[model samples]
Target: MGVLFYGSAEHAIEIDDVALAHLKVVIATKLRRNESFTLSWMHDSGQPLGRSTIWLHPSIELRFAFEEPTPPPLDPAKIQAYANSANTSGGILVPEEHILGSSRGVVLTA
Candidate 1:
């Protein structure tokens, strides 16, 4: 599992390492262009049976930490899917499962 530390140092979201890798690419691209967007995802089991969304901006303190020292290979399809979603008004909505192994499918919101 990888941790996405956004804003507050204590605020962290645990995600699959591979999924975070794909998302990192898309997020970096958007932030490099000074674009701000939202990222939404379904809550994990044991949590509230709902979803959550967060605003992402270049100025915000963002950090991604992986349990593995090396990052796994990134999938272009997944990256494209994330980028496509991030380009939308609703930004990127991640599946509760790992993107590379999940069947939930990529959903883009306008």
Candidate 2:
């Protein structure tokens, strides 16, 4: 598991490392261009009983922490899919299946 610490440490959102890695790319790209967007996702724990949306901006602080010391190899196809979502009006909707799916030949570091 990985945690996305947004705004502050107290506002950490749990996500898998693969998705976090892909999200990092899309987010960095958008933020680099000073583009702000809304990112929504269902709560993994279902504590919120629905979904949560956050306004991502260049000025906001974000952090991605993986359980493993090393990062996993990224999938270009998955990255492109996520990037497209991030570029859309709906913004990014973390693809759970793609994130937790089989690695195929991709090696994940512990």
Candidate 3:
């Protein structure tokens, strides 16, 4: 299964290719100016099943926020699929909950 990462607050930047590029630009510029901030995410295990970390720059206080206007409502069928595939791993397999989140860290696909 794939793990999606979303910012913890509404309006946080979503880390897509375009946004990541923007992040790089912002980081480079901010670092040049000496700034710091944090970046964090939760794995898609639906529990406290993975590690979360944050990053900071000298001049950028990056607050992890949810770029999505609202988290998509949970789907029961997808939950069943996730439960069925919980034990499998490897390859890019993104469950329904992550269709709109970042596509990085995809390992196992069904």
Candidate 4:
């Protein structure tokens, strides 16, 4: 899995491919419209929340890692089953344990 770093320190906010793609689109759209602000997301662990300030630019790389093998496809039925299980918590879109494996990419505009 890839690690997110802030300068020299590692961050707790690990973004997977699916989330990363969506983020890129959202940011790009906003940037194209000349919008600049902070975007925040709460972590699944619930202990640490994270945010980043986004700006319009052609140079930002939108960095992420795809070094790990892809995870098994998520079955909606299985997702539902585990969602209701006593061991699980509700409200997260994609479960944290598998975030790095199931990410997709988005095309960017110059």
lDDT of 3 by residue, 13-78 (tens): 333332333334444444466644443344434334563444444533444233345444444554
lDDT of 4 at 17: 44
Candidate 2, residues 3-74, lDDT tens digits: the string is 777896455666667777878888888999999998776544335345677899888888878887887898
- Model 4, global lDDT: 0.37
lDDT of 1 at 91: 95
Q: What is the lDDT of candidate 3?
A: 0.37
What would you estimate as the lDDT of candidate 1?
0.78
**Candidate 3 weakest lDDT stretch, 10 residues:** 85-94
Q: Highest lDDT: which candidate?
A: 1
Angstrom error of the Cα, residue 38, model 3: value is: 1.1
- The TM-score that candidate 1 achieves is 0.85
lDDT of 2: 0.70
**Where does candidate 1 have its weakest 10-residue lDDT segment?**
101-110
Q: Pairs clashing in candidate 1?
A: none
RMSD of 2: 6.2
lDDT of 4 at 79: 39
Q: For candidate 1, write residues 1-110 as lDDT tens digits.
A: 77788998454777777788888999999999999999998755445456778999999999988878997988898899999999999999885554332233222211
lDDT of 4 by residue, 1-110 (tens): 33222233234345544444444455455546654434333333333344232232334434444325664344455434333331223222333343322222111111
